[model samples]
Target: MQQYNPDFDYKSAAEEVLAIEIAGLKQLSQHFDTHFVQACQTILNTTGKVVVMGMGKSGHIGKKIAATLASTGTSSFFVHPGEAAHGDLGMIDSNDVVLAISNSGESGEILGLFPVLKRQQVTIISMTGNPSSNMGKLADLHLCIKVPKEACPIELAPTASTTATLVMGDALAMALMRARGFSAEDFALSHPGGALGRKLLLKISDIMHSGTQLPKVTADAPLTEALLEMSEKGLGMTAIVDADNAVIGIFTDGDLRRLLSKRVDIHDTTIGEVMGPNPQVAHSNMLAVDGLNQMQERSISALLIVDDGQLVGALNMHDMLRAGVM
Candidate 1:
């Protein structure tokens, strides 16, 4: 078994790699000019989707770029260059834009599709390291992602070049997002199953315990009755309401513990006398993420749901957790 070296300069080696990649990224930024703007404008004005194609390492980067573009309000998809020659070219429409990635700008697989893309009248945007190469010369707009050197010691594997490509893709996606005025709600619509979606889309009404599930009692009710309501509902608290069912106050497990420590008589005391007045309340339509922020800010565990000053429902931290909004 290979033993771990306690004196190994792993941190130094990692820093060296990061330094090389950072320099490569700085170099890539200098190459962004009129062609980059033209590429963005082409995609922004495109009526159809953006088709991304590459081979090998470029293919992997192309897939991620496609995903980023699609998720950020751009309709995009990745089609393997090899597969495009095998009938997948039908996926491309004349109105769409093609983004072909090749580190050397001479990938035969990607180059082979240029004729068909041209024949279909689709705009070709090429991302390559060399602007003088065949694919770059053929492209309607060429965005160069040239890097000074590979981060790999042997200079064989793609490291700095891939990072620069990924960053350039992100820049394009963000530029498109800003131009489209893409909001968080629009992003949530596309990512309805992700945590960010839950945070933005989930409302208190969707998760709050309503109707008979609410732990509530009249303000004049005995403290023992309030405790019974809390225990029966299993919410660790009970809302103290007036005659019109408007929340007047709230009694919780913390209040019970404090009362017990002070030797207060729970059997004889009225809930109105011991309940906390003016409890924090939430609207039914309020976002669950906002509720979580309220709870954290106020250092509380539960909130009473109200509408037009009448108690309607209730929820706690556990509900937020179960809904994946935490």
Candidate 2:
């Protein structure tokens, strides 16, 4: 029977595992050389996708590697080696590059697809701990992910080696990202459903309230009228525009509170008398993130969008939050 100890040093064991994995990653870094460069060149030159394949634990890591590569501008997908041997080999084309993973470089399922890949004229890049093994020998290029030891206490499970392999895959993906000049905008394009996509791809014009939705009161309008526009628009603010529809000032809830504190008559005062002059403004094309930064830096909650020196639209902190640009 297996023994259980309630006093086991769980924290120490976890720390030891982390230390071993860190050491393995450091060792893996030392193997980056001409082979790494050649692998990158081969993937970059391929006209088709990078088909990643592996078995067991390596297959799990291969799926993640393929995902990272795909998101970072390297077109790629993961294919289980076992499935590939049974008619899934049709997914690979002569123009595609294959990235196969195996710690021993001799996984039977992966090895079985070698002749088919070779016959299809597909370029093969192998990642393994043993460069002398069959998969490495048959590959057009080989990447070494050898580690000094496994983090598992029994030295049988794949722990440190898998960590090192993941780090190597990340390195390759980032190298390809840099070489392809993949910008944050490009990344946002690939991830359009997330907050990052909103931050990078959303512009001021896309979310700012304009035209009939805009809260506006001429600079000569009475403070009561401005307050009415603010309440009707529900933006907590109103733009004080001049005869040419240019924003000369802005009247917000903060200004109204200050005006009330001064015992001023809302019915008697014009918006120009109580409005904030030269309020912070944004251009229609400005990124919503930049607009948010401007609002944060100035300690203000609202911004007027201007185009060619004319008030075009307006939005406040609440709008930014609602649009997911906050």
How high is the CA lDDT of each candidate model?
Answer: 0.93, 0.93
Highest lDDT among the candidates is held by which one?
1
Pairs of residues at least 3 apart in sequence or in different chains that clash in candidate 2:
none
lDDT of 1 at 243: 91
Who wins the TM-score comparison? 2
lDDT of 1 at 171: 93
Pick out the ten consecutive residues of candidate 2 with the lowest summed lDDT. 24-33
C-alpha-based local distance difference test score of model 2 = 0.93
Per residue, candidate 2 scores C-alpha lDDT tens digits across 281-318 of 99999999999999999999999999998999999999
Candidate 2: lDDT of 125? 95
